[model samples]
Target: MTKNIEHQFSMLVREIRKEFVGNGPKEISTRFVGSWAVSEMKGNLTNIEKFMMGSKEGEKMVHEARTGLVKKIYSDLSVRRKFEDLAGAAILRIFSDIDIEADIAMTIFVFDRPLISKEK
Candidate 1:
């Protein structure tokens, strides 16, 4: 299972590098824990629309893209094959809200078992 997870993570890194960098350099890190996948990336997005990402509209665009990235990851074949449920996720904060150059982290719930709630 560890090997499989590593392989899946590698595939994800490949996708990220291909889609964002296009044979360029980008810092990326990923981890898999108990059906949860986390990815931290920096220098992923080059520019915002046409202007710099520090602009007001650029921040909005990044926020919107963060939402869309969830759907995009879930749609991936590797991600889809790992876990069956993607309804209620945990933390999925990709792209820095302040600057596009900042590190972005993406966390996926990817729960394979039933979620349990504690009753007080």
Candidate 2:
């Protein structure tokens, strides 16, 4: 059941990224840790972004743009509501970062409560 939730959550996250960024990660692996859902993604850089990575200044710009954009995108009330409904928990915050050279990104969803139910 938990695995199913993780898969669904990952798909939703991918969809969100594709919608906002016009491209999604080639791969996404998500896991639940307490109240946090951590997703590691690969192949997230677009062709233009890959080219920009060739320069130090361009790399900084890409990093800043992607990181800031992702945070702002997730901060949308509608997006938050979607995640909340799917995860069965309210999202308190979101943390996201990326590595331009590696074409990797990490998104952590911090919930108000644990996503996994502990059986008594």
Candidate 3:
């Protein structure tokens, strides 16, 4: 049941990125950790972004822009509601970061309560 929920969460995040950012990661894997959902995403770079990797400034720009944009996107009320519904908790914060050279991104969704039971 947890795996199913995680998979669904991953897919929803991937789609959200694709819809708002114009490109989505090729793969996303999610895990629940107390009140946090940590997701590692791969293949997030577009062809233009790959080209930008050739320069230090370009790489930094991409990294900053992607991280900032994602955080803002998730802050939307409707978007936050989707995640809250899935995790069964209100989201307190969101953290996003990306490695331009590695084409990988990490997102951490912080919830008001644990998504999984402690008794388990």
Question: In TM-score terms, which candidate is top?
Answer: 2
**Better candidate by TM-score, 1 or 2:** 2
Cα-based lDDT at residue 77, candidate 3: 96
Worst 10 residues of 3 by lDDT: 111-120
- Listed in order, each prediction's TM-score against the native is 0.52, 0.96, 0.95
Model 2 residue 113 lDDT score: 96
For 1-115, candidate 3 gives per-residue lDDT tens digits of 9989999999989989999989889989999999999999999988987788788898888888888899899979999999898889999999888987778899999999988
Q: What is the C-alpha lDDT profile of model 2 across 34-92, one tens digit per residue?
A: 99999999999999988888899999999999999998999899999999999989999
C-alpha lDDT of residue 8 in model 3: 92
lDDT by residue (tens digit), candidate 1, 1-120: 555554555465557446643532265555655445555555555444325456787767866675566467556665554333332334332222223445454444445432333349
Whole-model Cα lDDT per candidate?
Answer: 0.49, 0.93, 0.90
Over all chains combined, what TM-score does candidate 2 have?
0.96
Question: Model 3 reaches what TM-score against the true structure?
Answer: 0.95
Native-to-model Cα distance after best TM-score fit, residue 90 in candidate 1, in Å:
16
